[model samples]
Target: MIYTGFMFIVVGIIVLFRKIYLELQNIKIIIKIFKQQFSSTYRNNVQIKKQKHLTDLSNFIPLRSYKVYTIDQTTSLERLYMLIEKAGKTTKFSFSTYHDDESNKNYFVIDFIQPSSSIIINVEISKISHVLNDKLQELLSIIFYSSNTIYTWNYLSFPPVDFLIYDHIYSMNTDKINPKNFISLQHQFKHWYNRTFKHDENCQQIVDFVDSDGPLCSCPYRPCKFPTDTWSLSMAIMYTFHEHLQLNENPLEQCLAITKLAIIIEEGRNRQRIEALRSPSIHT
Candidate 1:
């Protein structure tokens, strides 16, 4: 009787162990299935973002009939002023600077464009006389006083604009210049990108996929997730256009890039407005 009782107790223990082992195997299988689903969802989300970027590129509008002028000391300031005056309210300004190590002075390259006239002017005021600098300052003040909207990537941090604005602040009549006329394209891009893509479903998935507790994808290539921190101009360009823009201090190139980005962002906003109008929400 005692031997039989012992045998029964042993069998019961073995049975309990086997049940626990089977449950663990089932749990492993469940985890495998979950990982597969997660990976598929992540890939799908990335693909959606890529498609949107490609769509943006396809909608690009090329600048037409624009003439670029590199104006120096010898160039006619009168004609330049006339061109600027004719440019009217559709002018954009950008600037770059070159520091002379020997002279220890910063050289300014001021570039501006008139969309209506399709004229781009690049002026080198570094080598110009004090009289010429004053005239240039006057020209800039005129743009500020006028209804023309000036665009820059980051005017505060931008060397050319910074020096121009601060150095000649007294001369430019700071009170008359409406602060609203200047558009910082970098700030605009950040706002646009954050609204359009940064907080999207795909970005969230990217956060999840790279989580320590989550399984990593087996694929060799991992698409970069949108930044959660500070957004730089280079990052903005890379994500928006899917092309790497070489960083430089060239105001002409910067201006062109800024203009293009603004147009693209504006176009996107217009489309969104149209879509919202077309698709009204049904009230329950």
Candidate 2:
């Protein structure tokens, strides 16, 4: 009788394991179905929005032109506004009449990511296409360029503008970055820095300041190293933007970090010098 009872228990255990495996397979099928449905709905919604915006533009555009943008963080907006304000100050022909015209909107695209959403303004560029070139994608690209944000906020194209970027451009706190955001942010930062600041005057000065004993700030530190000309010292602050792995609010500390990067590059050059000196046969 004892042997019979043991045999029964073993059979029950085997049946339970089989049932568990079957249930897990069913769960996997269900999850796959849900993801497929979600993806379909998201694409459909985006298409509808694009169609609606395009329909609205058809009425206003003379040559059947359209413009769109997806903007992010506060700095991106600041850069946008800086251009718009300069346009306003310079008395851009379209700036004054964008709003007064019944059919136009002056400042479009003012969505925010997290903390900066609260401060976004709702101004439009109602008459930009009217006064400026009908094709704004090329011009907006130049004006809205900056390293702080990841994507382009200006498009001189029609709806379903897949090539155009329509995402938020927020400056992460730099201390604690979301892993997904950090990856894209790091990539965009490198691309923009290389393009924009490669020949910037302040960037050159910061390189000099670290090695040549230049002034620490506007006023000389009196005993400074890494010195260079102080023509556009203010731009050195932008170097901090690229130093994402290490960011501090204090501009002075950021300047120091910039100095350190210059130090690393300079050190590399010195090492090459030393190696060349030791090897008479090798022309570096």
Candidate 3:
């Protein structure tokens, strides 16, 4: 009996130690993953900061300054107003116009007026697109819980008609816009903006056309001039539309895929603009 008890105690100790060891190994693996993620994030942040600093410095000392023409204020304002009016008919939303001191004097401002409990639309163009995507997802979740309509109250509203001309002038003068990729970039933006505001069946149809059928067949309008592709247009719509719907937290992989795609779109825009400026016409 004594020998048997001793044997049992020893086996119990062995089992406990094995269990502890496995738990410790799991903890170590988790720690390593966390460290790697932190390191990668830190490096990315450093690179972004450096790039922004360089851009700001370049603005001060112009090697080849490009001209940026202001948008036709009256026309831009009218277009924005019209868009809001169209969006308001289907959704319960309103618009209020506000003018900042600088914008009031310089540019037009149209506020997408909403209730106090309404979801506010905040676009952060400065941050990396990936970060912005995550932020947008979070914002949309919050908006979904609180309000039905998401309002993007513009701090500065420029007319849609003058968008191309203004971009051309800006690219030529300040080197801000890229002439070569300007058309594609604008198309991407138009699709993105439409996806954000248009959430109904018609919106989905447009999204499908732009994303899958190619740009030529994607635009529903009679004279669709913009380039729409299955990837860009559909992703934009999915990202924007999903915000208003109830979300599940389990499919983290799917969420990440969407976020990554958004980042890709943003990166493409940035690269295209820069490449356009490097073209022979700009050099001369």
Candidate 4:
């Protein structure tokens, strides 16, 4: 009976140790999250200052705002430019030929700065609704390699109206349309943002968040699941305004550039996973 009682005590001790270990792991995760958030905010504040400086420079001076990623020889600029062409004629988007000047890197900008009206347009829904699916699929193809993965990591708050509904609205009333009519669609997309972000209301915060660096939607949002595409299309729009029904001129170029950026990010994440596997002491 004494031996059985001693075994029970040993088991209780073992269980207590396991609980402590799990709690410690949880604390570590929380610490890491806070560190990342703080780091991001600091970088954003610096970028905002830089953006103000660049904005006073000139028009057509490619804003230093495109997302940058690390790429080696395998990710050659020539090869990437060719891929952009394969998607569509790269010239349509005014994609400069891949030059190894080292000063200028391969990138595409989507923002339009109207000096007269002082209106800066960042993200816009495509008026051509049919193309939305194809562009999104093309983007997903390079990032995930399969449409199947889209459902697994659903992060994009895509525009609500399909081509048919948009056409119906256009035919019914082109003159005077109320923005309030599309309230339902806005509500539907509220749940699609990353980590319980209130996309509809808080997404407006993105207006001031953009500058020469890139769109900073990190205000209330945790790291977005699809940061490559979603981060580039940082500012969003409701279908209420006529201006909302527009997209970048060379949609394919922007899509292709974002895909390349996605590749760099995934490769980094992949390396981290491999390193974690090698280091058994390192809790992932």
Highest lDDT against the true fold, candidate: 1
Tens digit of lDDT per residue, candidate 2, span 1-284?
99999999999999999999999999999999999999999999999976764453211101112122322222254455554543332210110011224544223332121211111223333223322322233223322332222222122223212212221212112223222221122223233333333323443334532223333323221212233322222232223221122222321222232232232232343433433422324322
lDDT (tens digit, per residue) of candidate 1 on 1-284: 99999999999999999999999999999999999999999999999987876554322222333467665567666766775565454455544444445546444444455444345666553456656556666666666677766666676543335445445533545667666766777766766654454333442244533331112322212233333344465555555544444434333444455655666676675424423322223100
Sorted by TM-score (best first), the order is 1, 2, 3, 4
Write down the TM-score of every candidate.
0.52, 0.23, 0.22, 0.20
Total residue pair clashes for candidate 4? 2
Per-residue CA lDDT of candidate 3, range 192-236, in tens? 444333333443344534443323333332123334423333333
Regarding lDDT, does 1 or 4 come out ahead?
1
The residue-level lDDT of candidate 4 at 225 comes to 30
Of models 2 and 4, which has the larger lDDT? 4
Over 161-266, each residue of candidate 4 has an lDDT whose tens digit, in order, gives 3323433422322223222221221123223333223334444334443221125444423334333443322132111100111233433233333222232233
Number of backbone-clashing residue pairs for each candidate, in the order shown = 0, 25, 15, 2
lDDT of 4: 0.33
- Alpha-carbon runs more than 4 Å astray in model 4: 53-284
Write down the RMSD of candidate 2 (Cα, Å). 24.7
Q: Better model by lDDT, 1 or 2? A: 1
Pick the TM-score winner: 1
lDDT of residue 276 for candidate 1: 39
